[model samples]
Target: MPIYQLGQINTAALQTPGLYVQVVPPRTRIINGVPTDVYGQVGVASWGPVNSATLVGSPTDAQNFFGVQQVRKYDLATAIAIGLQLGAANQRIVRVTDGTDVAASVALKDTLGTPVTGATLTAIYTGTVGNTLQATITAGTQQNTFKLTILRPNFTPEVFDGISGSGATFWANLVSAVNNGLSGIRGPSQLAVATIGTSITAPNTTNTYTFAGGTDGAGGVTDSTLVGVDGTSTARKGMYALRGTGVQVLNLVDLTDSTQWPNISTFASGEGVYGFTQGPVGASYSTVSTSLNTAGVDDWHMKVLVGDWVYWNDTVNTQNRLLAPATFLAAQCAAQAPHVSTLNKRLGNITGTQRVAQNQPYSGAEIGAIVGARLDVISNPSPGGSYYAGQTGRNSSSDPTRNGDNYTRMTNFLALTLASAFGYVIGQNQTMDLRREAKSAIESFLLTLQQQKMIGDVNGGPAFSVQLNAENNPDARVAAGYMQADVQVKYLSVIFYFLVNLEGGQTVTVQVSSKPR
Candidate 1:
């Protein structure tokens, strides 16, 4: 028996009697739920490919990809570290710079007659992390040859052995070894690259050289650098680098520019992401509310935290630094399911806040005012308990009906899941069978979500309803190349306010009832 591949074949043409089998695709596509915990951050970093989205799942991964977090503003690694501390499992970080970064470099002198500069070795990536790299030149095991060793902190040393030549030829051989690789010993150097100098002699001395003059270029980094450009796939920069990176929650590290919140909101809406932003550090609650109101930043996809920068233990720099709350909030929210609300949920890894560190927590009036303004706040004593937790789950949306974090997350999750899952149905002919198949796929997926309690039944009706019959998808519309699947989903509401009715005074009557067996 011969098995045939997928295609339209004439079975009648097969004259020979044989058992032929052809595998047909599934009648309906299977719809899998998209992940809701991939956090994306764009900020400055010590070392890494700039304008690229790199996956860093833990602090160790982040340290390896972006170097250690520096004690400075807009540190991408630090934000990632904090997020990891707060249970951010999956993260895609994009490093940005101010265009003035310089790679770490060192000069190696020629060992013949005159010990002039023979070649210059430069770090492959720009940042202060490159300064930790060291290059050593020593005698090789082979006769009339030299060996070069490159060492970096926490990494195995790379050794290029048996480099033989004289003057410029010798330098050229060394540079080629570092840039490319030896035949079988190792791959190309990951730390630095070498450039040969003109009219030089061979390096014949054993000397260890330290790299220097590496700049992170963070001082000149501006808001535009963080927002980035989406010119093209090859030229995307900053947050744009995170496009289509499967990021459910997005944050710009410690960005506090309210002027750009609108732009971020728009991006989040288009990308099906929940964006986290912050107000200015130490700004009063009234000020933040006024600023947001005036800017008209009432976006359902945007969550604006205000007036509560917290002091986090920056173990990387051995200091307690005051940082914005957006990164931490974004990570915590991303760790949760789409239907879960962050309101009253305890946030971890917080030492102190601007309000609490000064012995001034948000008063009841202040909390009410801030929440009323459609902004979120984090405090030590929240309604849930005494541990640090979100005061409210409000997004920047002015509409009260669409303001909760749960609403934004659940909406994005459903919309994006449907959008991704239904693309396979686009080219299929509009028939009752096709419509039924699509409807079945969608209902099965939604039923799973309902069983998981991501959505729930409302008013004795189903949690969701799908309409794909001729009534909704008219013959004229189907003939005009339009196939529609009308869907209505009822998202579970969050309990923001709990009402308790109590009457226990002497004037109140108490009744005893029989208990169930």
Candidate 2:
């Protein structure tokens, strides 16, 4: 018998009674534990690099990298706040700007009203904010030294002190001064880096220097324009550009309206391409579901679809408003992850009241949880609230599991880890030694899950089983290069109801007979 690739074979990869996979996305590396604080957030910046995923450390760093929040037509400030709330302590986020406009730098003219020969003040980025900036050159205490002060919106005067007279370092000096001054202040600035040619630095008697002809250019500014970049440019555009960045476990938080939703399915089918979505979908479950289906994808097409219509403490508005359909779902996940990190736990309902979350309806107030095939969150409402934390995974209506990504990810994680390990350690040999090594690894991993109370043999039987022996590896099949691993996990679903009947005044206490008539 000739050997066949795992996909080419028709027989069960492993003849177990549980779960297994015929094909696994190719994965080369397998690190045991998961990673946190790694997030990709895209939105508009008043000033900063565009389409580039620059890692930032703090809110100040965020302001430095992407400029202050300018309240664009489309905003993601809410997501940023939520991620921060969920443990942004040591996390470094990849910050990106959706803006594609050009920098507005124009010539600084001389005292005679003529254009200065050498330097021009360019706002560190492109946008209308640059138009609001004006630079003034004033004399210094020293003979040739001078100070250039930049007036900006909602900012104190940024005084670029100690500039030299010679035209040699004027541009460099100005750029350095602007950056230094900007950093010292908390408010972000449109004035960042600069370039200048030969310029007469003779201190002007009038403190203000004249600059002219600065325009933001005709570029996309609205929500669609911000997210519509096709990523053809090397720097790329919007979230589409971030598809291949290898920024693992994205959590796929959408801050830019709902535009971040549709294209996530297109993030390239890579083995490690795993993440979750907190669709700030400003609409209802049906709406989000309809959109995903119409786009030819389900909530579980490639990621977990967690439905939430509310987010806490609007960073921009400072109002704890409902997320409409759902927007801050990512934040909710982040806030609640410590309780259960995508384990087979249900979110039930975070809101403390029955049929309410955050003082709103327990879930959506109308529905208990989301219906149909996708995985969703809702308030159980019986004991106040508990997000139906039992079932978690992004599954479609056609899927019987009905669980969200928790279980699926477990199976996938184990399967892929095993598959990759087997491929690397065993090579092409389909022998008994190969089967033993694979089985050991699978059992060890499963045991760890059981110990953690994640999964187990609750029924006094194997909650899960792995099979990879002579039966699966027939004499005809072993030669072709296929080793089957039929593994199954008995996921424990959350019990929503427990029935008990009470016949009026019936008591079992010993005192009941003495009190009876």
Candidate 3:
């Protein structure tokens, strides 16, 4: 009669006479349009004859199968960027005090507030009355303004509740926030850029010359006589020019030596020829001069050239004055924004926030509560309770086992149920822990890198790759099958990227993947 329909046979005939069967194993059922098993028969039963005409099966199992649901990977890059933003926001909350006009009229004070001349002063004030100064006689002496300035760091939370958002978008917004916060800080007047050119020859020594004028020798009879007098002979004694006018020259002499000049006694014998008549011996004196102009055009050109060089050199100072303030603000904002964002992100996300709230300690009470809730749901009369209804007969009222199969299948099924219920929670928690460690390491690296000033732009920020060893963790372990089949979970690898920008434009990308451990 109806071929002894063994829980509704799938085929008209059975392939084997005896095999354990149900509508189908829950694991074999389709979920989210994907068959749970890649290659396996799902639903209905078959037994008895190889080809039986009376066997019948339900149409729903074959026609209405769905696919299994897939889990999502964590976004590490986004987490890092968010953390940085949080740090920035925290930094901004601290005040920055100005010391510019504090002592303009009172001969400036040192950082200690002791009155001093030509000194620089900088201080922060929280408005406590302990160190308040009294009014003085000077016009601007009552400069009791608050010295502390407060800035808000950049930070934003990622909205993961089926909303549209990304790490890059969040970072861009964070950068903008930081820039805005820092814009209020006063900046330097100029920014300087320096350049050096090729060198020229060094200075050396040179000489100058002079000459003497003279008269004819025959004219000495009345003035002095010219022995071989031509009609042009005349008597006079004067100095004559030996070198051209306005010629530049250098005179070389050894200050340490005194005997280099001619002796006066030798010169009086007329051999030195201070004066002589023209006949066999011509009247003349030896002297030296330079051709290069060392004084007129040369001195003027050198002085003008040096003055121009000095003027060009001053540009660097000017530039520094112009750009110092803006650059300082930009760097401060950049650093602060990323830190704030990171903190906020960690606090706002489900896994991250929960772990942080719980203070990173495992709570047995919390775990027990969750397990108790799950047990209650499984025992209650829900639509899916029939699968577990038979368990009530096998064990005590508090602990039940599967009816048909031994405790092995029953335990496996329970464990599977538990996993299905809390898999997300486990993954989230594990991810949070790994992320915390990764972030700490990254932050340390970033601090060091910033000091080096290695990265030039926001696009070139630091990145991290994390490999999580989560397979052996308590959250992932579960019993299965007759031989204690450990439900193995795949390892998750995450890459985190970071960026810093001066103009409030920064972005980062993170990619995550899973692999069997």
Candidate 4:
């Protein structure tokens, strides 16, 4: 085609083995050098698809995929809303239904104690929230006309009117009507994987359909549920559903629950997934801060935000201080890709966004950092308000070599992400070209990070460097089909304290002093 369209063309065809000519533009590969901004969230939504992950890009997507705020059901929805409001531009939510692979569904029943035949109504999801649903059938003005009302949680009653059961499109239209919702209903969905049929005749008598058998297992979510029991089984639901979902971070919002957060965090870390979580909601801010600022079981593969203040709607904004941290951290990470530190920053400000102060309602010792438990909330001099002041989960307990500061974790995550991508690209390359290509890719990635100030600026210096070549991959090892990459990272430090002493009102000028005078 090119030969026929152009007078002359110099192309790769008929070229020597060592050289070629081409006109195609080079394809640039752009990938997140750190954990991608995509957030993988797992929650027990009162209404929405269950046991599967649904992609949600906006607040509306969140509402459509998961139910709106219910006093007992906002475990997932609230965090997602806060994340979006803060900065999560892309996200996915996994609505957990029951322990194991069980689906906690509700079924409509008839007067005879048996499930009604035809026009079956199942909640869009399987959970206790299904109990809130109320479906009713009533008479219409015209003959053979019937009105179907679906009263869903947090949504207006959906009334399907002027139904002619005689038409062939009856079942399809009825399903469509239920799916699209009536005038007032929008978010709280009635049909999760629910279905309705055409076999039932028009209602000559009024009947109300109610569902039963929804359950929240006493054991919380079982271990096998979050991380699939095995590879092939869909029984491993929730976070496991995020496998091919393209999310680099999995934010489990409830750190206090001791059920979902710990299990999900362990799974994420084991799979090289990076994310953030809120401090364990203890009795006070001190305990929460201590849990986050120090390390033990709850601190690996993810960072912890140690504050109990968040902004939701003003009416009961202060009601939930623990739920917003994962979202706040997620938003910040998304906005400043790989810059996961949200310390000393304000989260949200709109009327929909409420400002929650630290949990230091009684003692200000930890708040002012007088006790020096990592970083605590002090008055924000620049912003004229208060904000969190620490961005790390590292403490005296964690390893100093691999993770030492907030920036160090981000750096490691960036390097690892780049390395993962490099491995894939190199797998396609010839064995002989592995070292050269891998080195170049890694070097370019680190260079970009340095230029963007996402990581510390250490040259081939002891602080930061990546080495891959013949030295690390010897001819013997190359022959054995082995590849290795050596990486070292060190982050810069900040001065958090400066002691100033006034000795007996001396007349000496207090100017430019790093020493204790």
TM-score of each candidate structure, all chains considered together: 0.92, 0.61, 0.11, 0.64
* Candidate 4 off by > 4 Å: 1-35, 98-118, 127-233, 238-240, 243-250, 257-265, 275-300, 304-335, 349-385, 388-397, 401-405, 423-434, 456-466, 487-517
Alpha-carbon RMSD, candidate 3: 48.2
Q: Give the per-residue lDDT digits (tens) of candidate 3, residues 1-517.
A: 2344333666666667665444432222211111111111001111111101111112221111111111101111111222232221111100011111121111122122332222111111111110121111111112321121111112121111111112333223222322232234432111111111111211011211111121111111211110111121132111111011111110110010112111211221111111110001110111000111111111100100000000001131222111111111111222321111111111111121112233442234432332222111011121233121110111101232211112212222223333343322232333444434433443443344344442123444333232333433334342321111222211111112245653433564544578743
lDDT of 1 by residue, 359-469 (tens): 998888888888888889888898867889888888889888899999999999988888888776677667787888899999999999888988886555789999999
lDDT of every model, 2 decimals: 0.86, 0.49, 0.19, 0.53
Q: What are the runs in model 1 whose C-alpha is more than 4 Å off?
A: 1-7, 10-20, 116-119, 140-146, 162-170, 199-201, 458-460, 506-517
TM-score (C-alpha, index-matched) for candidate 2: 0.61
Best by TM-score: 1
Better of 2 and 3 by TM-score: 2
**Backbone collision count in every prediction?**
0, 43, 69, 5
Query: Across residues 205-239, which tens digit of lDDT does each residue of candidate 2 receive?
Result: 46454334333333344444434455464755665
* Candidate 4 lDDT by residue in tens digits, 1-517: 1223221344435554443333542234444564466777776665566657677778777766665654442367776776776677678787764543223343333233343444566665655556666776666567766566667666667667755564334544555566664345342244543466434433324566666665544136533343433254365566777766656666654544434445556665555566555554333446655555444443336554444434346233445333445555555555544444444455453221122243223244444442234322212221324443232333222444433335534654664686567556544444545556666666676667667765564444444677877788888987776778787655544323447865655676666878965
Candidate 3 least-lDDT 10 residues = 303-312
Q: Residue 244, candidate 2: how far off, in angstroms?
A: 4.2
lDDT of the structure predicted as candidate 2 = 0.49
Instruction: Provide the RMSD of all predictions against the true structure, rounded to 1 decimal.
Output: 2.7, 11.5, 48.2, 8.0
Error of 4 at 70 (Å): 2.2
